[model samples]
Target chain A: EAGVTQFPSHSVIEKGQTVTLRCDPISGHDNLYWYRRVMGKEIKFLLHFVKESKQDESGMPNNRFLAERTGGTYSTLKVQPAELEDSGVYFCASSQAGVGNSPLHFGNGTRLTVT
Target chain B: AQSVTQLDSQVPVFEEAPVELRCNYSSSVSVYLFWYVQYPNQGLQLLLKYLSGSTLVESINGFEAEFNKSQTSFHLRKPSVHISDTAEYFCVLGADKLIFGTGTRLQVFP
Candidate 1:
């Protein structure tokens, strides 16, 4: 089976510009997650989706960041008025739903550089 | 609240040598421990996990991790590592949500 794939492996945008990162999860996976790492910090969870439904979004940093999963397929994370602090790697992961022990499969990630 | 700590930021070792990467976590509830390896420009790959029963977990790549509740650690070890084993290893804990450590970069020299 194909793994999770992401688009635009690297993106460069100005501080106030808008950018959208896409994540194509593995086929038949119901659980999708988004995480980000800034500078040299650890990867932090942003949100999760289960079949196009928002499971949890408590990790979202602010309202400027919006995420959506349409048709229970690919997911998109859009950042408006991107800040310099948003420059980092954004990783997308997915796994089988209702299975706590199931491991997550991640995409190569999109490296966003906001100047 | 939970957090992970990778004590070593980088570890350099000669090929075929044994190595250990220490990891510690703080959580009020029981957690599932995991070890993931990330090659340069690649996504994170699951190496092993300790979900319950048998405090020791082994990976197909000869990597193993022991979950110690007393120490609140899940340290990964490899008895004999090759150059191919070089990668950044992250120790993570998963509960209602997943939490990860900063990661430790392992470099194997020939």
Candidate 2:
């Protein structure tokens, strides 16, 4: 089966600029998750989408960061007025079954560098 | 609040030598432990996980992790590692939202 795929493996934007990262999860996968890792820090969860509905969004950092799964197929994360601290690798993952037995398959994250 | 900690920032070892990456978690109740590895220019991959029943879990790639409830720790270990094992390892807790450690970069010199 094809794994999760992300667009624009690397992105560079100046401070205050906006950037959008895209993720296409595995086919027929119901659970989609977003995660980010800043320099010298562990990967942090951003949000989770179960189909078109958001299962949980408790990890969202701020309002400037928005995520959308238009058709419950692909997801897009947009960062407006990006800050220097927003520079990191954004990863998207999907699982076929429940969180217990089904392990999450991750995509080659999109590395964003905000100058 | 749930949190995870990895004491070692980096570890270097010779091929065939044993290695261990320590991980600890703070949670009010029981939690699931997970170990993930990230290779250079690649995404994170599951190494192993301990949910219920067994306190220890093993990955197909020769990596193993034991979940310690009393100490609230899950450390990854390998008896003999190959050069391909060089990567960044992360320890995570739970499913809905995983609390990850700062990660330990392992460099296996051959």
Candidate 3:
């Protein structure tokens, strides 16, 4: 089976611009998650989606960032008015079951660079 | 809340030598532990996981991690590592969400 797929493997944009990253989970997977790793930092959670509803979004950094999982098949993360600090690798993962029940399959990630 | 700590940011060892990567976690309740590896130019992959039962878990490629409740640790070990073992390994704690350590880069020289 194909693993999770992330679009635009690399993106470069200026500060104050807007950027959107997309993720397509494995088929039949209901749990989708977003995680980001800043340079030299740990990968941190961004949000989670169970089907079309968001299960947890507490990790979202600020109002400028928005995530939507329409129909629950895929997810998109948008960072508006991007800041220089927003440069990082955005990874998407999916699991067949909830947190502990299943292992997450991650994508290669979208490397975003904001200047 | 929970957190994961990978004691080593990097480990260098010669091929066919033994190696250990330490991971310590902090949580109030029982936790599930996982080790994920990212090979060069590849996405993250599950190396092994420990949910219950045996405290020791082994991956197909000879990597093993032992979960120690007393020490609050899940350190990975391999008696004979190959050059192909080079990669970044992340120790993760599974709570309501997955909390990851900063990651340790394993560099195996021939």
Candidate 4:
């Protein structure tokens, strides 16, 4: 079975530019999550999506960041007016809902560099 | 608040040597612990997990972790690590939404 897939494995953008990272979850998985890891730091959770609706978004850093899951399939995270601090590896993960101990399947992640 | 902490930033060891990666988490009423490893250019994969019954859990790749509730720790250990074991290992908490620690990079040399 194919695992979670992320687009544009690497992305570089100017400080004020906007960037979007995409993630395609595993087939039939309803729980999609977004996490980011800054250099030398722990991976921090951003938000979680149960199908098309967002279940939690308390970890979002700011309002400039937006996340959307269309048709409950693929997810996209957008950062507008990207700041220098936004540079990091954005990882996307998916898991099946209702399973007690189901492990998450993650993507290779997209390394974003804001200059 | 929930959090995971991996004190060792990096550990260098020779092949066939025993290695331990320390991890500690904030004391909670109930917790699910996991160790996830990421090899070069690869995504993070579950190495092992400790849920309810057994405090000890083992992975197929000769790695094991014991959940110590009294100490609030879950340290990963490998009796004899292989060179291919070089990677970053993350200590994670939570069942659905995971809270990860600052991974420990284990570099196994020949």
Candidate 5:
């Protein structure tokens, strides 16, 4: 089985631009998660999705960030009017079960650079 | 709120030597502990996890971690490490969401 896959391994955008990151979870996996890691910082959770519905989104940084999982398959994270602070690696992960029960499979991550 | 701390930011050791990476967590509620490794240019992979049952957990790659509830620690150990063991290791605490440590970068020298 393939692990979680992220699109556009690296992205460079200007401040105030919009950027969307995509993630395709492993087959049959219903639990998807988004995390971000700024330079020299620990990875922080962004949100989670169970099928087409959001399980948790308390970690979202600001109103400019939005996430969607359509058809209960893939996920997309959109950052509107991206800021310089948004430059970091965005990781997408998926698990076979709910949180704390299954091990997560992560993608290579999308590195976003805002200038 | 839950938080994880990795005591060492980087550890340098010679090949075939034993190594230990320390991790401590703070949480008001019960949590699951995990260790994940990321090789160069690769994604994060699960090394081991401790949800319940045994306090000790071992991975297939000769890595082991013991969860000490009393101390609120989960330290990873490898008796003998290879050059390929060089990577960034993250200690995570899972409550409502996953809280991660800054990570410990292991560098193996021959």
Candidate 6:
């Protein structure tokens, strides 16, 4: 089976510009997660999706950030009016189950650079 | 609230040498511990995980971690590491969500 796949491995945008990162989870996976790492810091969870519905979104940084999973197949994270602080790696992961012990499969991640 | 700490930011070791990467976690509730490895230009991969039952977990590639409830640690170790073992390792605490440590970069020299 193919692992989680992310699009546009690297993206460069202006401070006020908008950017969208995409992720395609493994086949038949119901649980999807989004995480971000900024300035060499630890990866922090952003949100989670189970199928087409959001399971949790308490980690979202601000109102400018939005995530969506359509048709329960793929996910997209959009940053409106991106800021310099948004420059970092955005990782998407998926697991076969939503249980506590289910191992997650991650994508290579999209590196976003805001100037 | 849950948090993970990787004691070492980086660890340099020669090939064929033993190594240990320390990790400690703080959580008010029960947590599942995991070790994930990220290679150069690669996505994070699950090295091992401790959900319950056994306190010690081993990966297929000779990496092992012991979960100590008393110390709240899940330190990863390798008896003799290969050059390919060089990568960034993250200690993760999994409950409702996954909380990651800052990470430890393992640099193996030949």
> Number of the top candidate by DockQ?
3
Provide chain B TM-scores across all predictions.
0.98, 0.96, 0.98, 0.97, 0.98, 0.99
Model 6 chain A scores worst on lDDT over the 10 consecutive residues at: A95-104
Docking quality category of candidate 5 according to DockQ thresholds? high
> DockQ scores for all the models shown?
0.72, 0.74, 0.93, 0.69, 0.88, 0.84
Give the least accurate 10-residue stretch of model 6 chain B, judged by summed lDDT. Answer: B91-100
3 versus 5: better lDDT goes to: 3
List the candidate 2 regions with Cα displacement exceeding 4 Å. none
Which digits, one per residue and each the tens of the lDDT, describe model 3 over residues A3-66? 9999989999999999999999999999999999999999999999999899999989999999
List per-prediction Cα lDDT, in the order shown: 0.94, 0.91, 0.96, 0.93, 0.95, 0.95
Kindly report the fnat of each predicted structure, to 2 decimals.
Answer: 0.72, 0.77, 0.92, 0.74, 0.92, 0.85
* Local accuracy of candidate 5 as per-residue lDDT tens digits, A2-78: 88999999999999999999999999999999999999999999999999999999889999999999999999999
**Per-residue alpha-carbon lDDT of candidate 5 for residues B33-55, written as tens digits (9 for 90 to 100):** 99999999999998999999999
Q: List model 6 lDDT by residue over B12-96, tens digit each.
A: 9999999999999999888899999999999999999999998999999999999999999999999999999999999999988
Q: Kindly give the stretch of ten consecutive residues in candidate 2 chain B with the minimal lDDT sum.
A: B92-101
lDDT score, residue A113, model 4?
A: 98
Give a tens-digit lDDT track for model 6, residues A1-115.
8899999899999999999999999999999999999987999999999999999999999999999999999999999999999999999999989747577999999999999
lDDT of 3 by residue, B23-107 (tens): 9999999989999999998899999999999999999999999999999999999999999999999999998889999999999
What C-alpha lDDT does candidate 2 achieve relative to the native structure?
Answer: 0.91
Candidate 3 i-RMS: 0.5
Clashes of 2: 0
DockQ-based class of model 1:
medium
- For each of the candidates, the C-alpha root-mean-square deviation to the true structure, in angstroms, is 1.0, 1.2, 0.6, 1.1, 0.9, 0.8
lDDT of 4 by residue, B1-110 (tens): 78888999999999999999999999455878899999999999989888889899999999999999889999999999999999999999984478999999999999
User: Tens digit of lDDT per residue, candidate 1, span A39-63?
Assistant: 7889999999999999999999999
In candidate 2, which residue pairs clash? Answer: none
Clashes of each: 0, 0, 0, 0, 0, 0
